[model samples]
Target: MIACNFSFHYTSFKCEKNFGVFLAVITIDLTSISVTSAVISMAGKVMKKESLSIEGKQGEQVSLLIQNQIKKLLSLFENEPIQIKAVGVSVPGICYSKTGLVWAPNIPGWDNYPLLQDISYLLRGKNIRIKIDNNRTCCILGEHWQGAAKETKNAVYLAVGSGIGAGILIDGKILHGFNDAVGAIGWFAVDRTYKDAYSEKGCLESLASGKGIITRVKESLNIIDDYSGYFKDIKIQNLVIGDVFDAYKQKDPIAQKIIRESVELWGITAANIISAFNPEILIFGGGVFGPGIFFIDEIKSEAKKWAQPLSIDKVKFSPSQLGNNAGLFGAGHLALGRF
Candidate 1:
C-alpha cells in the first residue's frame, strides 16, 4: 500500500531542447517507504521521480531497492546529456555519514549495517557522490532548507512520532555530536521514579510517543475488569494510535487520561529543547502528528510551566511544513553538499 508521494513519478522525463546544461541530483528516503526522486535545484524541476514499498526489507534487501532505483534513474536519461551528480539517502537511527554504517532499530537485521558499502557496490563505475545521514538530521535539514525554520540559524526539529527524536541546528549548521549520536533525546529522564515500562525505550519515548501512548492505553485496557468505551468495537490486538486519538476526540475517559499525559510530556520535552538550544523556533512533525497537530497550542501551554521563561518567550513552536517529505527534501539538499 506504499505509494509514491513525489508528484513526478509519471512518464519519461523529456529532454529540454535549450534549457542549458543542468547538474542533476537525486535523493531517497529509505525507511518502510522507499521515497526516491531526482530534483534539479538549478532549474527548479524534477525528473523520473518515484517511491515504492520497502516494507519488511532490511540490510542488503533494502540496499537492493535503492540500487534498483538508481539504475532506473540512469535508464531514464539513457543517451541524454545529464548525469546524476549525487544520490543522497535518509536512513533511520544513527548513521556514520563517512563510514556508511547504519543502526536502524526498526528495520530488522540492520544494526550497525554497512548500508553505504552495499549501495556503493551497485554504483560501480558511475562517478556519483552518495550522501547518507540520519533521518533526524535530514528532518532538520529539510525544515531549514525549505520549511518553517528556513533561514533560522538555530532551531530544533522536535519530531514526535512512533518514537521521539530531535534534529538540532546551531549557527545554521547541524549539531552532529561526536559519533553522530547527538539528538537521541528519547533517553531524557522526565520521571523521577523508575517504571519497568521505561526500561526498554526510555522514559520519554516509553510514555509519550505513539507507541508509548498505545502501550499505556493497552495496559489500562487490560486492567479494567469490565469496560466498553470508545474502543468497544476494536479488538485490543488490533488497537492503534489513531484509535486512541479518535477516542480522545470523543473524550473517552481512558483515552483522555493517556493523551493528557502524552501532551504534558511532549510539552516538557519541548521545554527542554527550548531551554537547551534557545532556538529561534521548534518544528514538530512525524507520524503521530497527524492528529497531534491540533494539540500544538496545548503543548505550548504545558511547555510554559517548565520551559525557561525568557527562552520560552523567544521561541516559537510550529508544525513541520514539509510534512512527510521533509526527509526526502533534506536528502536532496544533502545531495547538493551545501553543508
Candidate 2:
C-alpha cells in the first residue's frame, strides 16, 4: 500500500506490504477550502483505495487542519514500521528541498518556511525520510513517473489550476533555475493589453487561471457569480469549470464564448512554450485541465497559428495520464530520485 501527503512545502508518500498484500497508491490535495486524503491497499496486481475530502475555511487555519490530517494518517500506520519506507511532499512555489526552504503563494506564512525540518520534527526519530519539490516540477516528474510523458524523455507539464505553472523536463532532467523558480510560468506576460492593469506584467496566468477565467467572465457578462448556463437554473457562484464545460456541451452561448476566449489564450501561451522548449510532448494537468482538455485540439490548432511552426509540429499535446495523482506520484519519485 502507498499513502501520500501534500502541503505548503512538502509532499510525503509511504508504501507498505504484508507478504501477499500491498498497499494501494494514495493521493491527497491540500487547497484553501478542501483537504483531501486517501488510502489505498493492493491485493495481487489489483489495487483498491478510499478517499475523503473535507471543506473548511481557507488561510492559516486550513494549514493547521492539514497538519492535523497528516498526524491522523501517521497514527493509522503507527504500529507498522516495515510497511512504510519514505515520505515525499510537493509544494506550490519555489522549493529547495536540500535546505527545506519553501516559498509558496496561496498559503500565507509559508515564505521561506523550514517545512522539511518541521515535518521531520513531527515525526521525531522515526525511520521515515521526507522528499519535497515545487508543485510544477512534481507535476512534471509525476507525469513522467506514471503519467503521459512516461515514454518520452523530454516533455513539459503545464498545471492550469487555481494558478498557472509549468514543469519542464529536458533530456530526462527537471530544469531548476538559480532560485528554483524555473517553472513559474504564471508570471510570463503574453499580452501587452493587460500590462497596465496587471502592472506591466502580463503573466499567462493573469489571463488563463481559474480565477482569471472567472474574472474574464464577470467582466464580459457583468455577472458576479462563477456559473454560466440556463441563467435561472444555475447559479454562477456554484459554477465550476466542469459546469461550464457541461454548459458548453449543451450549446450554452455564454459558455461557448468563454471557452473560446480561454482556449485562444492557452494556445498562445502553449505556442510560446513550445518555441522556447521544443519538448517532445506537452502534458496538461491540474484541476482546470479536466475541463480545459475539451479544447485541446482547438488549442493546438491555435498554437500552430502563433508559435514557431517547426516547434509546434514537433510537440504533441495531451491530457495528464495521472490525473490528480501526479503530484503524489512525483513526490514519491522525488523522494526516491528514481528518475
Best by lDDT: 1
**lDDT tens string, model 1, 1-339?**
000111112222234332565567677886644545555443335565787877767678877777788788877776676766667788878886446678887777888888777767777677776678878888888888788888789989887777789999888878877677788888889999998877767899888887888888988988898877898789888787889999999999999999998899999999999999899999999888888999999999999999999999988888999898888778766766666
For candidate 2, lDDT tens digit of each residue in 7-74?
23433333346574443333334543354544323211212223344343434455555556566666
Candidate 1 residue 53 C-alpha distance from true site, Å? 2.7
RMSD of each: 6.2, 5.2
On a 0 to 100 scale, what is the lDDT of residue 122 in model 2? 64
Superposition error at 196 for model 2 (Å): 5.2
CA deviation > 4 Å runs, candidate 2? 1-28, 37-60, 97-99, 195-202, 223-229
Candidate 1's C-alpha runs over 4 A off are 1-19, 32-48, 79-81
Residue 119, model 1: lDDT of 66
